[model samples]
Target: MVPTMVLVADGTRDTRRKEALHDLAEAVADRREAPVQAAFGSPTELRAAVESIEGPLVVVPAFLAGSDAASTELLAGLDLDSRFDACATAPLGAVPSIVAQLVTRLHAEGWRPGDGVVLAADGGPELPGNSERRQVIDVARMLSRRVQTPVQVGYLHAWAPSVSDAVARLRRNGHDRVAVATWQLVDGADLHRLREIGATAVTAPFGPSPVVIDTLLAQHRAATARLAA
Candidate 1:
């Protein structure tokens, strides 16, 4: 049987962002026979999500990156490990399609080839595993290659080179048209900051973009295949 999917996302107070996450869950569910649900916030919520589902279960993290860490901790906390067959898939940022979406969104927002660019992400930690930082760097590299323009990493928080700083650096280097490409799943405060921070253009969050849906399905297929193997 196709495994049940629980999409784990950070809880948001924003009504639109919450709806967008749910809409993503509905879209994924529509394409598959297996049940798909979105779980927002807390290990307790995640545990409850998987405990009730029978047979195989796959929890897909809705984060752009670094969710693998959360998944590990949450899965370890669950006593249901032996009660049902379950596993956590990699975060969405690990996929190439997400980087592709950043480019697509940029172009849609009038970002051209010659414009200097900053890849904006919700900041990751500077300490510990630092997985999110690594993934964001990788994404910046891919986006730079795609656009034929150097892309700088400007974190929303918890790091050096804020979005404004990155934009200023581009300006210093003679790039007046600085575009900020957002690598976020849903609209939120970080995106708002990216827009107001002097970039020539800012892209919107991916919020259920086609490639995002593709990424989820691809991960699910790969996970189920590994289990079968």
Candidate 2:
């Protein structure tokens, strides 16, 4: 079957963000053993590609949270039409493999067992759904368990306990060294904010990692399996 992978992201005017997304798409396609075309854009743009492509398609929302309004809206918009054979899996943040990738990233950054870590994301009043924030907290908890360190949740925007605040809280709690694990897909204002937060170390976003690519392919396979069933 001719299968296409549609990576849905929030529409951004930033050229860097677009380039990063394009790079990620290319990496995923390269790793895919079968003939797979990768398309990156908003829901409408992805839908156009899906309609034009012959055969089945699987949409993997590149969003970190299952509750992301943009991704949810995109999926909803696509669900309205049944003209194309398409299936969308859960967001990347919901995948268990992300926890492993987070741990790997932290260890690569020289994170010690006792170092306090903060999971930072662009969370605030502007984004819809507390679910996204909750997912970030869940990831923090998972990381805490993996590394045996205290991991806290921090926001770059409209949420309480900003990245700096979380770092301060960790310092006040008697942890001298603190690090930040960015919960983002690409470099943006959130990443910049994370860097300025004064953490001892800050891990980059999970951009086109092998684990991420595997998770995305798994999502596609699961959707395709369901379609076959």
Candidate 3:
């Protein structure tokens, strides 16, 4: 029997959101050996899609991992209806494996264990006062503690000391050649901006590694397996 799999995500940006959704869907389909349907829309639209679908639903955030107000809103809306058994997986940015990939990227970029580095994210304080920007800080703190480097949280848009600002600060503090690890899933505007600032840019493991496909596939398989259990 073929299990029903519905891939849904918050579709704010017409291009990037759609690409992330389908990229995830294709990855899931390839792994589950089942048919997967993709849905791209706002939170309201996603809730409606879930209500209409007869199979298991996996809601994946296009943004990095960690919970935010918008994500909380979506989850709250879903909780209003208990007709379906659904589970929201971690955002692509929060997967534990992502940390490992990031460490590898840093090492490859010549960042030793004690090198002062900044894990810069595109998220800013601008999205909303309670956006997921804090996740960046959380990740940076965790990584910094693990690697024994001083990592400070900053944003590219909504927060203080943007990546460039952070870079300048690091340089002024005598840490030259600061490695700017991009917390983006795919290469786009933010990546371009990082390059423009002359920061030594490094993408998250998913952005340049094939393991991203494997991770998406595993997420879907886990979702389906849970439903079956």
Candidate 4:
């Protein structure tokens, strides 16, 4: 019997976000025709899910940023002494497929070639200095290359130059149209705040789209391949 893959996300207080993650996991499972489960909340909750499953298990963090402290803690909590073989995979954002999805969202939001775009994310203060900001910047650069326009990065909190500031800077630079692309996996208050940033257009978060589902399946395949190898 092959191992089941479990997708884990940072549990959110918002019910909508939780429901979204659950729906995404179900979509992945149906598409792959395999056992896939979603576990939300703390590391302990994820660990319990992993333990309940029989056979081998692959735990994939459904985070936009590559493995964070929560993922690290989840892996630590897994019982190494258990008979089932368990491994964790990288976060969903590491996959390049998301770049195409970002471009698609921007285009759908009426972004033109010369339009300035701001990649908005929630930068939590709990993380180390500038880590989340830097990651968003890297993704912004990728978006810039794809769209052939300058893409600036902005944070909702714990960082300089909010999304509004980024849009303002672009407007000041003489870009008539400025748009915002959210670098979030699910909807939350931050996304709502992005819309109020006064940008000409604001794209939706990277939800349970085909690209995301494909990326997770690819990650699962790669992890299973490594185990087989």
Best by lDDT: 1
TM-score of 1: 0.88
Winner of 2 and 3 under lDDT: 2
Query: Residues 167-226, candidate 1, lDDT per residue (tens digit)?
Result: 999999999899988877766566666778978899888887778888888788877776
The 0-to-1 C-alpha lDDT of every candidate, in the order given, reads 0.74, 0.73, 0.60, 0.73
Tell how far residue 94 is off in model 2, in angstroms.
4.8
Q: Name the runs in model 2 displaced over 4 angstroms.
A: 34-39, 66-77, 124-130
Ranking by TM-score: 1, 4, 2, 3
Over 40-127, each residue of candidate 4 has an lDDT whose tens digit, in order, gives 8776787778778878777876767622334434544555455536677755553467987889988999988888988876655444
lDDT (10s digit) by residue, model 3, range 1-229: 4445555454554465357556766766666566666655677777676677675566544445432233334443454246446665555654556766777788877776545687777552233334355566778877776678887554666557677888888888987667876676654445566677776555442442556656765676787676668
Off by over 4 Å in 1: 66-84, 126-130
Candidate 3 residue 66 C-alpha distance from true site, Å: 5.7
Which numbered prediction scores highest in TM-score against the true structure?
Answer: 1
lDDT of 3 at 153: 53
Model 4 segments more than 4 A misplaced? 66-84, 125-134
Quote model 4's TM-score.
0.85
Model 2 C-alpha lDDT per residue in residues 9-68, reported as the tens digit of each score: 765445676677778788878975444654455666866766776777777777677323
On the 0 to 100 scale, the lDDT of residue 141 in model 2 is 79
**Pairs of residues at least 3 apart in sequence or in different chains that clash in candidate 3:** 124-158, 125-158, 125-159, 126-158
Clash pairs (backbone) in predicted model 4: none
